[model samples]
Target: MLRVGKKTAEDTQTPNNEIESSVTEWSEKVTSLLWLINADHILPQSYVPEGLENLPNSNVQVVEEAGRAFVRMTQNMDEPLYVANGYISATAQQNLYESKRQQYLEEGYTEERASMVIVDEYFPGGADEHQLGLTFDVCTDAALNLDVDFGLTPQGQWLEEHAWEYGFIFRGAEGAPKIYKPWQLRYVGETHAAIMEKLHLSLDEYLAYLEDKGTSYFSDVGAMHLDLIVYFTDSLSEIPLKIREVSGDNNGHYIVVCYR
Candidate 1:
């Protein structure tokens, strides 16, 4: 337990009597997750450091999940006192982050900072998800993942606003899956991206689709997607978008009316 606050076990028990009562008053289930920033030329100092560090902002993250606030330790593997090791992304994500930051700086946001993975960064065991390069810890940057419509920032709004534009999807958002971290983003490839864009399903709905439905579900989905595209596109009527249906129902390439 990160001990974001105090845990009580019925004032009757002595402090030593309730030494193992773990509870968070701020943890809440959300529909968000984070993308770990990575870079090639620059190796980020592993926030995962010496055994059991309890530093916020730089050391560990105080994420508010499941309505109760809990601390997610950002420490090394050998002495991991966390249920999950923050994800360390590949060099590609790092590059993307830096590039985006530079762009934002050019505009106004100077809060972007590159982070993740240190040389010999250790994790206790159990082949943590971060070890596989499949997970990433979200930073507090208000500007992230500009290329993806489903950006990881409040300024960008929820994935429902822009996820399909990029070749990514939210793990859960529609009528499926338990609402988890809303910041979590998953790369589902261009085809799925196009279809998702066309269908307008949030990350959650898409995952639900994969688990319960079949690829054959795409045909019907395609039509629904077409309608959404038309609706939003029309809303942007002032700015003409090159709405190109590069392919048919089978081809998952949707020529979006790119404003830029």
Candidate 2:
């Protein structure tokens, strides 16, 4: 098992000017990549992920970084990987939400129950991660379907074991509001994904883990022996000037990642 290193307050005495400079230098693009999206943190209808591009040989779109990672992952796989679904537009998500809601209603569920079911089972519009362009559903070329059965396939097994090396995490693996999707992957960057996989933490659990710790350090991540310095705080001034990335935790807080 990979061990997390001891936490330290090494930067506590850093000058205020440095911290402020960090805030100004931090890339907003990096900060937005991992924003948590759920019922409680629903995105606005006008929200759209920037720099979306078509995945190689597929019409499905995702953020440019995510697309590049996805391509690299598939190229390394034995059996070809296929995208079952990718980025969803706000309007399309709303339509899908209505369609599922109506279907549940037709199945004899009350209006209120239908809404609740969809919100829980099928995300409603802006409440979905698909709208973020950082999530994608994958399947093998042999069976182009999305289901739990895919988890048993060679492609799925490969992803489960090695996707973190390429920066993807198995979403909803072990947390609340669980939808139990084995075929879905979300790009949270290589460092974060490595930590999450090593610790067997779901996205929610990972965020909560960092929040509880305030700051954490991990050494020798993967074969690269990379040292990771992670910090969770709402104060922008606390962000280090030389950050690898920053992401919103969907709880009015920010997660800052640095390499040491």
Best by TM-score: 2
What TM-score quantifies how close candidate 2 is to the native fold?
0.86
Candidate 2 per-residue lDDT, tens place, 22-139, comes to 7876744445655777777788888888889998777899999999998988889889888978889778988988999999999999999997778667777788888899999887
Give TM per candidate. 0.27, 0.86
lDDT, model 2, position 153: 87
| Ten contiguous residues with the weakest lDDT in model 2 | 172-181
Q: After superposition, how far is residue 6 of candidate 1 from its true place, in Å?
A: 82
Q: What is the lDDT of residue 165 in candidate 2?
A: 95
lDDT of 1 by residue, 1-260 (tens): 55555657644354532322211111121112212121221223343311233234443322223101122222211222222223343343345445655565666554532112211122222212232232323433434322223234442253335434434455433211232344444444344566667666654354444434422223323323432221111122232332332211111211222211
